[model samples]
Target: MRATAEPAIAVTRQLGRFIATSSWLDIPVDVRREARRTLVHWIACAIGGSTHDTVERAVRAQLAMSNHGNARLFGRRERLVPASAALVNGIASHVLDFDDTQLGATNVHPTGPVASALFALAEIRPLSGAALAHALVLGIEVECRLANAVFRHANRGWHVTGAVGSLGAAAACAKALALEEQQIAFALGTAATQVVGLREMFGSMCKSLHTGRAADNGLTAAMLAAEGYTSADAAVEGPQGYAQVLNGATDLAGVVGALGQRYEISRLSYKPYACGVVMHPTIEACLRAREARPDLSARATAITLRVHPDVLSATGKQSPRTGLETKFSVYHAAAVALVHGIAGEDAFSDAMAVDPHVSAVRGRVRAQPDEAVRKDEVHATFSLPGETIEEHIDHVVGSVTRPMTDADLERKFESLAGEVLGASRCGRLLERCRGFEEISDAREVLAAATA
Candidate 1:
């Protein structure tokens, strides 16, 4: 008899089973702590971005079509259905591009999709903090692992956050509902079929829409599955399925190997600057160079940056006209970081982008890409009248090597949410997030976050 190949294991079914069977106690204490950090960071980002013009327009558009529900819109006074709330909150969390990022070959904002969907579901149904945390860990793990499995997903111009994010949202929602393994598999299948987002949408409001849509779509998928919706068991690995169609190749082991031995959530990195992750090293180097020679700005003849080649592809915009465009401009980030000594959300505004000082500085700054440079490393030099001051950063401030402290996260939260929620409320909200596992109802945290 001819040798026969064993049947392929269904990636979607395997992942769904893992998510379905996993419990809060199975999660590591460190993973659980990171989950709380992810939630706190996401909540702050959502609230901070809630008042943006993009969010205002989005809310208005959603209100026109949505029926009222019990879910609270973070940082706002209005309420919407869980689906709509997820959409809005997801957009808000990412509008500023300041949310946490997973550092690897494939970069995705794991929290935006998972946290957005999970919180929306919590509002509709009661869930303990432990339940919420477990779902979050599983959701991020699935999205990031899938991202790792797909070779060059970003190189093909597919925003992994929006494309793979749908699957993450589905897993989180399925876990939150305590669905059976089969139902969870169906949910992943349904969500996989609806993957949305394109890299072409970068530097526009539509980019944020990708995150929002992923959250809404995933939640909807899980809801349908709970009601006995049926979909392909091999939705992710089947012929012409997500991995094959989207990435052109798949690494099944990356998705399935060491399933519970390591947690991807622990590898998450928060952003100190409110822009693309690739620009962090450049910004950090520029900021340090400026500090070394405060007078360099006035006497400087030129500013030059040597960075990883990937930086230009992602944030190469030299002359950005708007704040949104500035987020994708490495030149603007370096300029503002040096001129203002900070790169917070305020530093990436339309006014800052067009400010005469920032524009002049950015115009003089030049970037050269070197293949040898790492993503988290940058070499920046400031040319002055007499001499040049050079600064090199081996590891960016927010990388896993130099992770943000709890105090740092708290400060960042206050900077983003204090204006909307007031300092006292922000403090309380921070405490509530830190003690997340003890909370009886996740809704209380959401209530505290709202204005």
Candidate 2:
């Protein structure tokens, strides 16, 4: 008789145990702080992007399918079923491309998927802020580890956020359900089979939809597992599993080795600019150049940015026609930053993308990919009539090495959420997020965010 294939090592089960057993108290003080920051940033992005045409259409679509339910959308008056809410909120959170990034091919917008699912599930049943925080931390820990494992080796064009997000979202939802190891493992497996996202979708509304789908599907997987649904426990590591098929490799060892001991959520960073995280350093260089020469944009004949090789691959759009496309254009980000001294939501608008002054500078801007350049660092030179001005960044703002302060995050929340919710109500929501762990019902935060 032919020998049968042995089961893959217990990668899914181990992660399940870690997530299942983890509690709010088990999270270190610093990790908890980071979790709150993640919430603040994610809520800000969701509320801010909530007004975007992409989010509006998505909400309209969801509303048409089912007009009324319990779960709340960030900045809208409408309510949706939990899964639909997760999908819509996830899309709104990421529609601005301002959501947090894990910095790599794993552009895993850590909390957008996990927290979106968690918050949506919170509405289905009462969950404490503490539980929300704990689940968020553990879920992201699972997500970054899984995304990191396959993203590097995965086929180019696979967006890691869409590929591994459902896995993390499932973990968080499973944790919220307080499922034991077997059920949690099943949830992970079911989610792993649902991976979706394409790098080709980067410059379109579909990019935000990827995150929405991840949140929706991940929540469905966990709820199914909670109801005794079954799936291959070795889905992440089996011979023809997610890893092998998606990337041909799985870091089973790394996935489980540091769980609980080291928290991945702490590594998450917020964004200062509303664009791809890789373009931040380049924008920083441009801003610095402009600051040094107040008339930099007016005088600089040509601008060149030297960034990590991945920058070009990720944000290489030299000429873009819309706001969403500009988020993936290093050239545009640099040009706009220099010309307007702004990188806020207004800077990447369709009108801004086609602005005469911005377009003129954008065309002259060039990005040279360098293997030696780090993702958080960039080099730039500005051509002047008689001399050249240069700027080099050791580390960009909002990077882990230079994290945004709590106050900075609050201001960001105020800025984004204020416009949508109005100043008074937005301030209340900001306060709720800042004191998230102290709240009794996590859904209160959602209730507070709606206009």
Candidate 3:
């Protein structure tokens, strides 16, 4: 007989121990470099999205709930309690749906929950840059591992970012606070029990709420555990535990096998377009097709896309009526990419969604699911008056295989944040993020990020 697998509880304990014991020196150099990149990308997103209508509404809602604390909001000059700060900043970072994504074990947005919770805590306390980076990596590890163990959680209708993100936030907060192993375990338990997010809420204000709540819930969990709050030690793998209750089964071995040997941050992918990652290939194909044949849009009678089934399942909205819904519509992505030649934040607005020309083009676009097509690859065929132009994208630009370089990331940051912080301040903030480890207080970085 084959040997039995380890219990889910073992995974939780191993993760807690690793977070409690690991230091900056324990992290690999490449992982550390990626951690900084992740932080900078997240901060830029948070700042750039701060002035968004969604963020404005969230901030207003949070302010109504509590108006007493001193944690800074990125890109905006507002103060809330650590938990509220985490909540609002998390929402802001993800409102545009442009945050960095990790596509290795799970497709969770790794930076939002972890960075939001950590920065909130840093503002309340005085955490050094090294400590903050270490915690950020540890936090991502815990959440991404949990995501790997429950790999199909998203397919099951849970937004994995919010579902697994709370645990990541808890881990990062616990590490930043220097929690003991037991405390860290308790923090995980608290976070695991309170996982929040559902795919039904996607493409709405509620979707951003999931990320905000994950950050808030995890920060709260860590704070509670730090005060000696007790929780189930086997919260992750126990009977009726997080994995069993939420996912029916868990890959405990996958969660614990390479605890510190490999870091999940290394598998991160930054989005070049402000839409679902699955739609990127289609957008790239459309853009490339447009570039090769500039008159393709005017000449094309129909556009057909062959893509992975998951692409349509995730982003198949035919007539997206709102900006938020447009982010999930692959048809809109393709249409805009072909018509406007760009799918940046400016391309996914309510106004852009309702544009007659864009609608005309998107109406002609059809996506057919093909299991043979890889998720990162797409085949787009544009039928003109007589001729057909075909574009095949085997590797999407933002995938790990074709990653955005540091300079590419900086350009993306400048484009997004320059509007909010102006060109000079955005430049300064980028420098600060690149040298985050040398900072004495992590809050200084947060301060510089704001307008």
- Writing each residue's lDDT as its tens digit, candidate 1 over 1-451 gives 7364322767888898899888788888888888888888888899999999999999899889875677898999888889999999999999999998886467688889988999999987789998998998999999998888884444588888998899999999999998999999999999999998888787899989999999999999999999999998788988778887887765676798889889999999999999999899988888787787676566777889899887898789999989999999999998898888878888888999789988988988899999899888899888887787888999999999999998898888999999899999999998899899999999999999987
Candidate 2, after superposition: displacement of residue 86 in Å? 0.2
lDDT of 3 by residue, 85-201 (tens): 999999999999999887533578978999999999998778999899999998998888788878644457888899999999999999999999999999999999999998888
What TM-score, to 2 decimals, does candidate 1 have? 0.96
lDDT of 2 at 414: 87
> Candidate 1: worst 10 consecutive residues by lDDT?
1-10
List candidate 2 stretches off by more than 4 Å. 1-8, 153-155
TM-scores across all candidates?
0.96, 0.97, 0.97
Candidate 1: segments with Cα more than 4 A from true spot = 1-7, 151-154
> Residue 114 in model 2: shift from native, Å?
0.9
